[model samples]
Target: MKRAEQVTFGGGGLDRAAHLRGDRGALATAWADPAAAVLLVWQGKPLSTRSGRGSSPDQLVMIRPDHPLAASHRENCIFLGLAPTGAPQFACDISSWQPDALDQAMLASFADASEQQHPDLPTGQVFTELRRMMAFLTPLEAELAATANAVLSWHKSHQFCACCGQPSQVAQAGWQRNCAACNTSHFPRTDPVVIMLITHGDQVLLGRSPGWPVGMYSLLAGFVEPGETLEAAVRREVLEEAGVKVGAVTYLSSQPWPFPMSLMFGCAGIALGRELTIDHSEIEDALWISRADMMTVFAGDHPGIRPTRKGSIAHFLLQNWLADTLD
Candidate 1:
């Protein structure tokens, strides 16, 4: 758990100038500066680039202020944090743009970014889903993408005020939304979810949701309910979905899972009993997976099971458990 932040998207030291976000003059200066760079996002995907031949190392597609797409959506540009070295960064959503067929094809290719082409930007750039390319991205790239997707998605969905039935305006460099009708302010929200690595003896509890692909199972997870502690949430979720009692829940690590903004609280727990009584409504199936069988699943040799995808907190926790590194 101590080394948990060392996971992907975990160790980036980006300086998020929270205090300066409310200053209009400072944000304008940063936006107009030549050194300021923007990451393009379209429909929750970030623009990434790859070099010739092989796609071993991929980079985020960063554009200058004067780029054609930089100002395409005047209201969609949100100020992301500054880089470690003090370069200003922003995320611009171009989801409204209509790309041609070729651009669409390039955007869909998760692997081999070398062959992608974008008509709206320079060569060697294509917008792809962050979840697909997260493992290939650097720590900084992962953090930026996660932040951008979460904040932008919030803006897109929360255009109205919850206090009053009036529309809200974005403020604080896209960090806050204010409604004039009721004088109410709203901040970006991150729903807390508890994903547990529950163990009984040598086996761990894994479950599959109803809509997940066949053979895909992950650590049991559920949203934290109102006024509930994280530890309590972990125990409640495991029991609710898998009908297994949990004891001594320990916090493992945290991840910014920005698929519409959620903070994943990774935890490890001890299952009080191993009897399987799955709630078919919450999870399609639940079973205990031995450490040996999990090894095969992670190794791509399992005949009927595939481990959780890389770059997810579930995968991170399971991998550490296998190596006996969950300290």
Candidate 2:
């Protein structure tokens, strides 16, 4: 838990400048500040100024946004301003148009050629003209990238009014949608997921889903359905997948996984049974592993069990669990 924030997309304490959003004079002042910079996001990757194939070394990203309109431009990208901390600045992903393409000249600092030229960068029909360059941006950059993807995805999926079957208009500076016909208001949504570590004594549970890379194994996770509590969701998912009963579920930590927006609730729970009647429909295979074997997986020495993906909560939790430091 000490390095919880070190996890990929953990967080950077940006000011978010929320106080200025509603006020014209104040918002204009912050927007005009030279130190107040915008974090640039293209596709889902942060636009890093640093030179690296991956991993932005610092979280400070600065791009000043110029809306040039009296009122907010609906569906325009959001530029969260951050006041400088001792080190880099902080940022919050506030506004953006519905899921847009990753193309052409974006409005941030110049990105390297590797990002502008990558094959994955061509999906954007709108800003696809931005050059491709490869570099590792800091957390601020990652946050902005997540912002673009989440907002755009929301907009793409939510064009119609939920109440009146009429098309809606962007409002609230890209954070809200309004039905012109029915006067209904809509907001961006984030889904919830529970990623659990089921342990008996020395061993823990692991499973693999269909079509995943060979030997890749991690904690069992699933969404929290409406009307279900986090604890209930965990028990349900565990039973449904590996046929193991759970007891004494407790909250541990949370991470923002913005692959289309999800909150991963890391948890530790006790497995009541060792027998794994895997529902082949839910998991390819499920079983218990001793701590000794877990060490092998972490070391990449396991013949069949693969380690958790880097930057994932599963990896974070498993690393701590093995070290006896989940406390």
Candidate 3:
């Protein structure tokens, strides 16, 4: 657990500059700085530029506010924070532009392609999905992309105040929404999810959601409901989904899963009994796999089952567990 934050999207030591968020003048000065940079996003994807040579490196595509593309879309710009170097950083959503015929054709090549180009910028700049490019990005880049996507997604869904059903306007450096009619203020939300590594002796439990890709399984997981503790959520979820009682849950690590904002609480729990009466409504299948077979799954040598996705907290825990290094 010592290297827990080393997980993808977990270790961006960003200076959020939260104290300056409420200062309109400070926010203005940050963005106006010549060194300020913005990460462009379209839909949920962040813009990235790659060297044409396959051996070369890929990087996040950043531009100044004065850049043509950054200037093109000002309505949805968000102040992310100051970079490690103390330069201002921001995210701009350009989801509204339409691509040309050539760009449209280029977009078909990747699952989430960056076919649309600013007339002033080079051709390789494309908005690509974070999942596909996560491994290629640095910790800071991943954090910026995740934060932008999560906060922007929240704004898109929470245009109206929940308290009084009145329209809300962006405030506090894009961190809050204020409603004039109801005097209600709302902040960005991050749901807590408990992803448990349940063990009984040398075996671990894995489950497949109803519509997951064939052969794909991960640690059993669920949201922490209102008024529930993280430990309680783990026990309740395991019991509810697989009908397997758990005891002595221990915190492992955490990951920021920004598919619309979730903080995955990784934990290990002891299984009191082995019987599994799977709740079909919660999961498609659940089973216990021995440690030896888990080794094969991680190596991609298993006969039928695919391991959990790399860079995930479940994969992180299982890898350390295999190495006897889960400290």
Candidate 4:
């Protein structure tokens, strides 16, 4: 887990500049600087620079400050404030709104000189695949993209007061939505998920969810229910999925998974039993394989197993486990 932060969007020590976000004057000053860049998101998809030919894919909804909606909605977005190297960062999601300037030309328009694709331009798609195809994003890009999606999504859903039917107002520098009628405040949410790598001697257990592609198997994972500790979540999830009792669960690492806001807690557990009676309700299939078998999977030699998805914490943990560093 030494390279815990190495995953793309994992940890780059971006400046964040939390203290400055509340200062209206400073925030306006940073945005006015022409060098300041925005991470573009439309319905949770981060904008990226395009590669390859195919008429360039139409991705992202972005425009300059002169645009009409810029004033009304931009304040609802989070100002990540600054990157570690001193560049400013911002995030905005333009999903539902119609930007007058959007067109095929946008697919070729590069953002901030970084060569990363922003999103799948066309409609009727979730942001999942677009995120997967990205190789990486600059620290500024990552910060802007994360902030925009997190804040905008919160605003879109929480326009009304939870305590009363009255409307709310944006507060906390776009970080909180407060209801004047009921005096209730709401903030963005991140769900907790426990992803575990269960190992016994040289063999490991993996499971395929109901809808995954063929050969796709990953570390067993589930949400951490109320009142459950991380270790208890690991033990219970493994047992519930594969019928494998686990002991001595140890935390490995965590990743911010922003597909609708999730924090993945990665852990390793001591496997107490090998016989897997998979709960079909939680997983489609579960298997235990030796180190030699995994080597084949990693090498593309296993006909039935595929390598883990790139940039996933599951892949990161498995790579460390293979290198004998999980201890």
TM-score of 1: 0.92
Q: What is the per-residue lDDT of model 4 for residues 135-194, given as tens digits with 9 covering 90 to 100?
A: 345433443555566567677778888789789988766777889887898887778999
TM-score of every model versus the real structure: 0.92, 0.76, 0.91, 0.82
* lDDT at position 169, candidate 3: 94
| Highest-scoring model, TM-score | 1
Query: Residue-wise lDDT of candidate 3 within 1-327, one digit each (tens)?
Result: 788888888888778989988888887788789989999887677888852237655578988898877876655578889989999998887767666554654443323434456556678876666766776678998889889989988988999999989899988878999999989999999999999999999999999986576899999999999999999999999999999999999998898888878999999999999899999999999999999999999999998899887667788888888887778
Runs in model 1 deviating more than 4 A are 50-55, 101-118
lDDT of 2 by residue, 96-133 (tens): 43344534444342332333332322232122211132
> How well does candidate 2 score on lDDT at residue 166?
99
After superposition of all CA atoms, the RMSD between model 3 and the true structure is: 3.1
Q: Which stretches of candidate 4 lie above 4 Å from their native place?
A: 51-72, 97-130, 138-140
Ranking by TM-score: 1, 3, 4, 2
Q: Residue 152: error of model 1 in Å?
A: 0.5
Report the Cα lDDT for residue 60, model 3: 88
Residue range with the least summed lDDT across 10 consecutive positions in model 3: 106-115
Model 4 steric clash pairs: 46-118, 47-118, 48-116, 48-117, 48-118, 49-116, 49-117, 58-121
Better candidate number, 1 or 4, judged by lDDT: 1
